[model samples]
Target: MFCFLIDIITYMHSNTFHIIIGPTIVKSIYSGELTYDSDQFFRTGNTNSYYYQAIDIIVNITGNYTVKSNSTIDTFGYLYIYSFNKTKLSINQVTKNDDKSGSLQFTLISALQSGVRYIVIVTTYSPDVRGPFSITVSGPATVGFHVNTAATKPSSSVTTTTRTTTTTTRTTTTTTRTTTTTTRTTTTTSKASTTSTTST
Candidate 1:
């Protein structure tokens, strides 16, 4: 008068998934020196005399990153999106910092995308200054640095443009100073009531 049911199931499938989160490298340190042989560039808003070194930044994950420098020299940092053109100092600039980490060091923060090429430019705040330095990058993944070996300088056209601008600026300043001096002399002469004052 009682009934019993039994069922057996068989399955054939298997899969494995590995997901990695967070930074693979907590901090990556790279040391280098900006010597006389290092590439140089005229930093934006600066004269053409600062020695600089360019490093290619490669990452495996997309996230925010912080780049800091440790050096005895007054350090300046620049972040570029794709490529850096020494002829055009600001063409691909994302951000730049100076002394943000204190003690003449710099700290730069920006969001970086995986598979995208980025360039970090390390230069000095003072012209022709050179010394050894170490840069540390902290981000979502280990950052790879490849030193760019290409020597860079402003293009001929850019050089011509810079010379023209400098000449124009100097001429303008000279004219302005001369005019001011003339005006001041006229005013003094008009105020002078005695012949001796006017003669002097």
Candidate 2:
């Protein structure tokens, strides 16, 4: 009997928005600063210039994954999974949330293809609402599969079973899972308020 095992690791970053190319799971709490003239901007309306900071990660497995951003002040979190083309990049999945009076959290539950680069952005609800914050990415670390060697002959004696175990670590941040099916695509967005928006 021969056994084959495959290990996958996802690298994620925070704060300075630096890219670390390697193989490992990332779960870190960062204390950073944000301002009106920070970095990238995700414009939804014609009000203020919404500034944002982004982190790029390469995913090698397909499964349900969650990303959380917690802050002392009101904030917003945005996630974008896309691919690059000859001229520009095309977005595959986009999720944004401004709920939970003090933080924002969103989950991407879709079939993520292997060898694809995904970008995750964490920002405030509006411009100039900046302070210390922490961001985390958690989900299944490995995806398992089994193959039977005696496929040519039909026999009831041969049995193959595969099991997958997923473990999640809990923190102060609240998590919400959003499911996305293959047949339909949905996008959820909420309008930012000047004050705090109570969660219902």
Residues 48-141 of candidate 1 have per-residue lDDT tens digits of 7888888888877888889999999999999998899988877989999999999999999999999999999999988989888888888655
Query: Would you estimate the TM-scores of all the predictions?
Result: 0.62, 0.45
| Candidate 2 per-residue lDDT over residues 1-200, each given as its tens digit | 11333333333312222222333343323334455445534345554465455555445465555556666766676555653121221345456667743335333333445666566555666665666555555433432212112121111111122333333332232345577867777999999878777898
Among all candidates shown, the one with the greatest TM-score: 1
Give residue 166's lDDT in candidate 1 (0 to 100): 15
* lDDT score, candidate 2: 0.46
Checking candidate 2 for backbone clashes, the offending pairs are: none
**What's the C-alpha lDDT at position 195 in model 1?**
53
